[model samples]
Target: MSDPVRPGAVRAATLTRQPAFWVVAALLAAGAVRIAQITGRFLGVYPLATVTAMLLFALLAVPFWLFLSELDFLEREPASLRILAFAWGGLVATSVSIPGSNSLENLIAKLGSPNLAADWGAALAGPTVEEIAKTLGVVAIVLIARPQVNSVLDGVVYGALVGLGFQIVEDVVFAVGAVAQAGQGDQIQPVITTFLVRGFLAGVWSHTLFGALAGAGIGYLVVNPDRTRAHRLAMAGLALFGAWASHVLWNSPLFREGLGDGAVALLAVLVFKGLPPLLLILYLVRRAHDSEAAYYVAKLADLRDPVLITDGELRVLGSGTRRAAARRHAAARAGRRGRAAVRRLQRAQARLAVELSRDADPDLRHSAEVQRQRTALTELGHPEAVEGDPSWRHTVSTVGTTVVAVAVLWAALSFLGNG
Candidate 1:
């Protein structure tokens, strides 16, 4: 969605013009070049298979991208930085980590028994090298765009994007490798099977989760610059440690030692291994989002400007479910146009709220954007009905749609697995 405020004064910051933006842009371009170099041989051999694999994984990534984007609703990050994060993960992290991880594995094999290295090499080497490589994407963004990441949630958004980019490319590589392994030149089956296991079964809990954990830590350091250096370092360390430990756990052979004995057992093992970290990251994300929302609510309330944002609007916008319901209510009262206008109004209010929430500043009322959004609310016809009890069915519809999407994907994966 476009920014709602006037272009004259409340113009969106020209992030592309920033030096840091250009630096990240250059890195992303370099990363893309490196990726092309790495994949050229495979692309030359199996152009069709590689393209199909890339498309499938990219399709699977849509819902996740939307979810992470929604998490940063109040203050969306610039698209350039978001794309940069994704490029870093898919290109730079993947390109560098492949050789680095192999070197680590090779060293481990030389130092230890081949059997031990075979079982544990990825567990050790991957966490040490891959986690850092992936996180460096977030760190680089932080270094370049210091003001962009204002909260832990911002870090999670960037981190998840990076991980997502990495996951898509890695999944494509795995799928291509699977086709090669099948050896019958049956492209579809191997690609489908790979997608079933990696994309469906474990995609959510893999690199994306690890990157978010690490990004939160990097965010903590940037967000709380006033905190003690030791405290910030601890936070950063914890973030990296959490990410490494999670990567180690995922890469370890402990689960594969015996759990593949039965189909049910294997499914159980997948759930057992993936669910905990998924739940943990979910919890952290929720906590960060809640803190962010609360901060915005307090800031909006402090403004005490009914013209711009009222207590009722603040209450409704504070919760995700409620926000959805308000839009539904607006649609019911008017039509699609009403819904669109209200959405624009809400976006303007949210932008203003976010601007005001930055460090408890009170003079944000003078911000040009703040004035524009206030004018917008009046012209858009602020509906008093939005503050009323929302239709509970609206919340149900939103959640039901998500549940149905997952079910359809699950069934599709199952069909592929069986065939």
Candidate 2:
């Protein structure tokens, strides 16, 4: 009663407090700089070529985005945040890192043996600069919206998005560079070669994997409130080190040792060099997903409300294929309306699970959102029960088949291209 807050002061406070505002500002600034750089670099020289490369790589990025997006089934990040992460990776991180890395490489060459620098510059400077730059995007997202990355899986999703942006942009850059280097008036071949090697063969275990590893540490630091600060710092450091080590290994010349100059040798190089890290990251991602799913499922175990989420629904939600089958079944039963309602129900249930985990509250029926979604589901004629998730064996088999198919496709493309 003694003091009334001024309207201006209130508005200022609100603006300063909003993480979303800062995020938007960062994206705009970074995006402007990036657009300027791209225009300056390519507009005068290879305008159409650059555009074509960007468009092609962007189209390639879609499948990767979809694949990584599915990993965060419980709580997807907001579109605004996702866009911010991508922009930071593509615009901010790449913008700064390119010049910084080149300078570092030049410095190393001047100070030391140029031949040694030429051979190991990437292994040394690339990992240090690139990992930090990409990881910074994840850190920025966490700083702007602490709640967006509530689990390791959430971190991985955002990290992957950031890396995806960086990957696409970098691929385009490499393709353009290849075109210029060839100087043979045939840009298509160079572009295709770059895309085949970078976009297809090395896409899986590249910057995206490094960013995810680092982001997992950052997320663990932000989410686990009870952990001691020292422990959190250690986790953060360990993650960065892991990312740096992985990047170093990838860029190192060790893989070139015994590599021959044939298609089979190239395949062997990819498999031997890329497979171990790919397998390691896959294991880490799966474990992170399992931990998050278990946490949310445990929170919802006692809940039995059909409107909110049933145990059967919980099982289906954790598995991607089951979720798809459930939606298909609903569509088959009551047409598109049923499918839409089921989606709504699933989204609401996911949101509620997130809220429950945050508050550590099992009794979520009293939440307004819970009641509203429940009413919506009932009004739409609650979708039929979903079949349970497949056994671990089936899931593994499906995943393995998908991986094999992708590898075979890449090999076929390479074989055809050489032919």
What is each predicted model's overall lDDT from 0 to 1?
A: 0.76, 0.72
Clashes of 2: 0
User: Against the true structure, candidate 2 has what lDDT?
Assistant: 0.72
Q: Which candidate number maximizes TM-score?
A: 1
Top-scoring candidate (lDDT): 1
The candidate 1 region of ten consecutive residues with least summed lDDT is 1-10
- Provide the lDDT at 298 for model 2: 60
Report the lDDT tens digits of candidate 2 across residue range 49-165: 777777788888888887877677766767667777777777777777778889888888988879978889988888888888888888877665665666777777888788888
lDDT, candidate 1, at 331: 74
For model 1, residues 176-239, the per-residue Cα lDDT tens digits are 8998888866367788778877897788789999999898888878777568899998988998
